[model samples]
Target: MHLVDIHDEFTHFMANMTCLSVMSVRYSSRCILAKKLRDCDRYTNIINYFELMYCDLKVRNESKEIGVLCLFVLIYFLFFCVVFICINEYYLPALKIAAIRLKLNEYLAGVLLVGVANSTSDFMLNFSAVRSGSPTMNLAMSNALTSICVMGGTIYVIMPFKINSASVFRDFLFVIFLLQLIRFFIQTDSPTYWVKGLIILLIYPIYLAVNIIDFLLMRYNIRKLRREIEILRYKRSSPMLDKKLYDKVTTLKDLEVDDDFKILRMKTRYGIFRAGVFVTPKPLVEPRKVDVESNRVLFHNKNNPKNRFLFTEFIQDLNPIDPEHWMFSGKYGRAALICVSPAMFLLRLAIPMVNYEQIKHGWSKLLNCIQIITNPFLVAILLETAYFTTHNNSWLINIYFDKALWSLAVTVPLSLIVFVDTRTDIPPPYHKLFSIFTIVTVVTLIWICSWEMEVIISIIGSVFNQSSNYMTVTFNAFSNAVPDMIAYIQLSKNGYGKMAFGGIVGGIVFDITINLGAQFARSNSESRHLLGDFGETIYIFLLLTVFSTSWMCLVLDFNARRSGGIFLWCLYVMFFIYVTLIEANVIHDFTADTVIEVKD
Candidate 1:
């Protein structure tokens, strides 16, 4: 009985151990499945994240592209608007005047029309140049050249008729000769400081007065002419009279009623019989509706007076008719004319005074004080004088003598006046510094005239053979004749006048005098032999020297005190380097081409 019970216990223990092993295996399988599931979930999540990121990137790129396209469209639209405005404001008015006057021949008229059209662009360019603060000399020279090329070239190209060379020469030569002589005289004289100051102060006022007077006279004449036309329209005149008379009457009425028209009329006494009248109007025309299918107005018959009456005209004539009912009649026109004249006069006068006052104070007085202080006219005169005096020897010597005579004549009186006018507000140090700087600059400019002449002459000699050089000299002289009369515009918004002038002078001196002089001087020396053997090395050395000098100057000036000093310096340097590099590359390429040709 005992042995059987022990066997039963052993069997039961073995079964329990087997069952525990099976349970362990099942738990291990479950753990493995859970681990696999977790890994799969993580991988799925990562994939989804990547897909979302890609979608977002695509959306962002599309949005950026749309923004750029929209910007381009806006810019294009603005450009068109500007072009249309230019045409309407300037070109159309001039063209209509030319057409009416019949002064220009058919070909000439076309040329004049084109020129008038281009004048808007020219005006904008001039304005832009003035804003840029380019020295007067640069502005005048550039404009003169551009105008000559544009006008002369266009005429030559478009006109069927050949230019009468003899006539052209006769017409232009005397004027050119006189201008050159005057320029020569002006350049030699040392202008009294006081005289210069007075002239500078008075110039804008004189210009304003003259312009205002001219405008008033024009307005008056236009008004008178319009009155005469209105009177004629009211007169019981038969259509059998002059067709011009009938048209003039209608045109007068049209001018008054038309929203597009802003006419100015002036009347002059041409004895008791009739009055001399002048009329002018704005250039734009209002839009009109028409039947697209028939290519005509959707109104009554053309011959009917009712159909002929414009909508604007009908609205304007809605008031009860009176014998004295002149369109723009009574005191309205006179009052408008009077009001505008005084306002304009006062503005013109006050602006210059304000500018001078600001200058008397410090730049802190006004953020844009420098721009105001350096007037366009003053800048132009100074620059033109500098360029002509430097480039043309005869002119320089003449101007020097003239300046000396003027100085002696005006100096004492002018100085006395300035002294009397001297204010207590001016600080002693500032006054002293300003006077000294002015004196030094003037003296330096006068002295540099001779040096500039020599350098310019040398450059001419080096660049061309004798005849070509002579021609070039003549061309340059003719091109620069009317220094004072030509308009000087600014080229940049920042006041970079000093730097621009300095750079120009430096470039001219270095290229014409230093480089050429060095080459000529070294031609017979041992350095010449070395240079001949290693020409590229010499060129490289010269280039590097220029680069270093220019860089150093830029660095020094970059830190120097002036308006927009550092920023202007950096801009100029970057522009100069970029231009120089481009030019150098072009020259190098050309030289390479020539060398290859020679070898071949």
Candidate 2:
């Protein structure tokens, strides 16, 4: 009994000592934390709290609202990401198909189609703004100028490519000249007559003519290159153009060269963070062969990232929108679709599906026969007692039936798109016409998605107490530019540098002339102005941005370089500073006419 009692007492003593040690360590840790907090200011305290989530800011739930911001940001990213996909995936594929089918130069097609499609959101936004009887078009004009500037700067900064296409600067020059032309029209106090707007709108045909001529010139060069390569092939007796031969043929080195003509071959230079933001030194792109005869790109491997944008890699993570995808996709694709199907159903309401080349759509006569009931879009737009009776035991068919007449209008033409598409089978030549509908539908989706995204962005900007003009210039412009920006950059990276440049500049031109013309043509009044005294400043900056880029390209002999990227970014910085000064009232150049400036 004595031995047991002695053991118990020793154990109790050890427990008490352990508890005292724990208390001492806790007290010292608290003291150290308190000292750190005392040494920090509010800004530092906030940083410390975020940097170390466990740290206290000496304030009560100051940034608890940050979660709200985060939620909104996540929502914004989702919508924004959708916009990105529509541009690159749906709209862009359509453009490519149209370009190839029409045999138009990629650069010209991008300038006309991608440019107009990309600017559709801004056009719609500004159109509605002006249609609302608001004569001020500061929001529209700011969006156009800021978008062009940011898009141009962002393209080169991300992926600089050689400006190889002939007369690429013509697009930029047209943009600048047309922009100034519109400025001259509304720069005065006279009512912006519909006649003047109509005149400005007439410039679009000339823009078309210039691009058509450029396309013809480029085609002549490409054809000449092909003929020369053919003649050289007869000498070399090479049946097909392989990688090494292509390098020689396109480059025209170590062989009889024609000094009169030149071909600017694509040279892809991957950025430091191009491969998943890691310093991976793996071969950036595999060598692929292009047959001038076939005009088809044959890849050495399936994983080649040639002609694909950076974000295209992440597309596999998203779900397919077609019902066939849900029915036929692998377990993973179906699972992804399942996760987003609810949102997709609503999103796909007015959006039509157009099948592309490799996956040409073929209407199964069986499916097309009963497509009235089988096709989701057709079923959505139509309903009958027979359908209810047939599917009554299986599922609720009424749930799929749409009562809206507009849905009928949308789905009627869309019903033809329900085709069984595969990679091996080729689609009909007539199917290329659907690219127009695809481009229009994708643009519509982008507009609706972006408009909602901007609503969320504007709310986010309001947290900083940002004014309407600031939101339009910074956030609204970004919303309009983002999908186009990423898409064009990806295209440029893929050696469509001239095409990308055309899309960027040509879109800006369309905005200034077509969109703005529509606004004034509708209102028949002077358009609303920019930030107090900042109207003329932004126009001047846009001109500078274009002029600077053009000068750099000409000086470099049309070689796209990192220095060009850096220079464009510097110009953007200067633009930002000037705009900020105006916003902050550091420089007030408001004249009598611009006093009643309209913010979005």
**Tens digits of per-residue lDDT for model 1 on 342-448?**
43332222122111112222111111122223223333344444333321111112122333343334434543444354332231222322322222222222222
Q: Which candidate is the best by lDDT?
A: 2
| Model 2 residue pairs with clashes | 136-528, 137-528
Per-residue error (Å), model 1, residue 64: 11
- Put down candidate 2 lDDT per residue, 96-181, tens digits, no spaces: 65665666565566677778878776666553321232223455456656555566655555554556434557777777677666
- Candidate lDDT scores, in order, read 0.29, 0.53
Q: Could you give the C-alpha RMSD of every candidate to the true structure, in order shown? A: 33.3, 19.5
What does the lDDT come to for candidate 2?
A: 0.53
> What TM-score would every model get versus the actual structure?
0.23, 0.62
Model 2: how far residue 537 lies from native, Å: 2.2
On a 0 to 100 scale, what is the lDDT of residue 217 in model 2?
A: 61
Error of 1 at 56 (Å): 24
